[model samples]
Target: QKDGTKERYVYACTPDGTVGRCNKISIRCSEVDEEAWKYVKELMKDQNKVEERLAEIEKKLTSNPVDVTPIDNQIAEIERQQRNCAKAMVTAKDDEYMSQLFQQEAHELAKARREAEKLRADVLRGMDDFQLVRSKLDEFRKRWLDHKTKLEEEPTYTDKRLACSILGLKATLYSAGHLPRYKFTITPPEIEFLILLHRAERQPRPWCVSVPAG
Candidate 1:
């Protein structure tokens, strides 16, 4: 307490060095931290769920491993045929109809080659996304499970901050009347998966104290 009034602690938006200042966007740290911990605790307790999610992600990745060998072979054969057609066209240059036939064959082969290349790219992209989600989930599991004991009992400020960082927690403060209102957002599982797939940057660790959560 400060002069009989309770001291206030908050998370405020950082301001730019010059004229760019935040419009006093801040949330009471305790409120946001408690809410964030509730969600983290729920997730931590559900080991079965976390394992299931990991299994699901692994199944997707393993069942559809990214192998572009077949596509590459297909493209190779198409290009070979295209080269043969070119040779045939040169030899049959006097025969306009035969040359046209070779030209048509070349066009078809080119189209098939393009399609094969596109399929390869698509396969690679899909597998990359799957791998990305799997990696993030693996990291989340490792980080949280490593601190299982501490989490089960009482998490320290550092533990809670770590959880909030991993979970992508966000708190926004606003004023409606004379009182301040705060909104909190926890990253949803599906959206988190998408975010990982899109290669979103990792969240920075929040400023925290070492004291246990009250």
Candidate 2:
């Protein structure tokens, strides 16, 4: 303890305990935790921000239209080649070399067909209909509302963490002009609508503060 004071600091360190890896960066635990919770509360309770996020999700879900016609054509071509190979194989049964060549070609074409079909399916799956998009967005909104209700109550540490997870929150520590600071990053949710996240950049020195939790 410094001067008989029970002081605590949040530290960034290397996994293998390498010297000088973390640049000897640290800050008061209370300071960092307080800053993090502030941002968390802001993000969780801001109804306008929530609506903006939902709008962004809806845009991402419906903005890009996927075309699988090329994939379909590729599959059709592969099938045609397979049919030709099969016919050739029947005629070349007496000739082992020709028969083997046709069989190998047929096998390769079949593999290509499978791959093309899978690509087609993936494209179709990603291209959710308008109704499905609405449903997913509605689900996300409901989840957010539920989380907000929990936040309004006295949320536990687990609840706090769940909020972070739902919002894809991340924390990073670094030095800002000899002062240790934290940066909170929020990535897009992994739920159906894949999109980018808006980050909160705060500092402790002159401009801003940081965010984090235990």
Candidate 3:
């Protein structure tokens, strides 16, 4: 909302006579990073015996051989620690321990996937919002086409199902090149939310169009 073409700016002018904006900040995930890295190192330690040896040998053949002093010390350290794992295996209740480990692993994987999914949804939502306010015509056109095609090819619906599902408003099923291309199913169990969105562009209320029954 600039007044009569008065200047508008995202960032304030800098001392060097240039507009400036800060780079996006990425929040620190130190704890998660450390935990993931530690797990990776532990897993690699178990599997790196032959792989590490081969890599070293290959590097030596192609470039230069690594100094043996440090390599020998690392090998000695690994050999010394190998018995710790062996001792754990020997003293463990294998079945119970493994079952608990498997459950924990699955729980962690699911938690990670959920967290990632939320992040993805957030980013997509943000993009949709930003686009709504400041999208190019080309971008909108492309998405409109995609949505229209999606509608033709797949209309997830039943009687009285509301129209207009929004995909970040990036795409709309009403646009060109996409209309009911094929049949798609709408299942009753798919109603995960009470409020439904659809692909039709009617007013934000239910329409009263007469259904012609055969």
Candidate 4:
């Protein structure tokens, strides 16, 4: 509802006939009032801008492979420094001053290893960000497709039934451990399986297989 308007909007109605108020709702542009249409147009423009930015991010991700050569070289160099420090320690077995020098070199090698590990962690985080963005884009695209279909099509009884079935299956998957239940240390094969499962869940009529009656 607008601040100065007398119009009241009902957003959700429960099975018990209870109505609820909502802050905002998505409506077709043609259905919006003139004052509201202005804001809707602005929102559409903003959505387009966001889509453009996502596309640019995706392009960069696809075109520029993450170069891990620097991290690899850093780790390799640190390893070499540690090996040299070990040799120095072996050579300075008797002299106290030489032993102190070797110990200092060993400390420096440890510091280098720490720095290299931090760099490797930073690179991994960058890769994770890219993957997270891509996953969000895929989810958004799926939701947009569903919304468009609902708005554009005059769904028949069969269509509605199919949609209900899909929703039910999605709910079941959520209840079960099939859908994204929790973040854990999973193998690459498990990750691939989850991706395939999610894709299957998103399909309109995914339950083609027969389930035996218990």
For lDDT, the strongest prediction is 1
Assess candidate 3 and give its TM-score to the true structure: 0.21
TM-score of each: 0.54, 0.55, 0.21, 0.47
Query: Candidate 3 at residue 39, lDDT?
Result: 34
TM-score of 4: 0.47
How do the candidates rank by TM-score, highest first?
A: 2, 1, 4, 3
* lDDT sort, best first: 1, 2, 4, 3
Candidate 1 lDDT, 71-109, residue by residue in tens: 888888888888888899899999999988988988888
Model 2 — TM-score against the truth? 0.55
Q: Give lDDT: candidate 4, residue 39.
A: 33
Cα lDDT for residue 122, candidate 4? 77
User: Candidate 2's residue-wise lDDT over 39-135, tens digit each?
Assistant: 7778867878767766765676567668898888888888888888899999999999999998899889888988899889878866544445456
* Candidate lDDT values, in order: 0.60, 0.59, 0.31, 0.46
Best by TM-score: 2
Report how far residue 211 has shifted in candidate 2, in Å: 14
Which runs in model 1 stand beyond 4 Å of their true positions? 1-37, 149-197, 200-214
Instruction: Give the number of colliding residue pairs in candidate 3.
Output: 11
| C-alpha lDDT (0 to 100) for residue 136 of candidate 3 | 25
Candidate 2 residue-wise lDDT at 89: 94
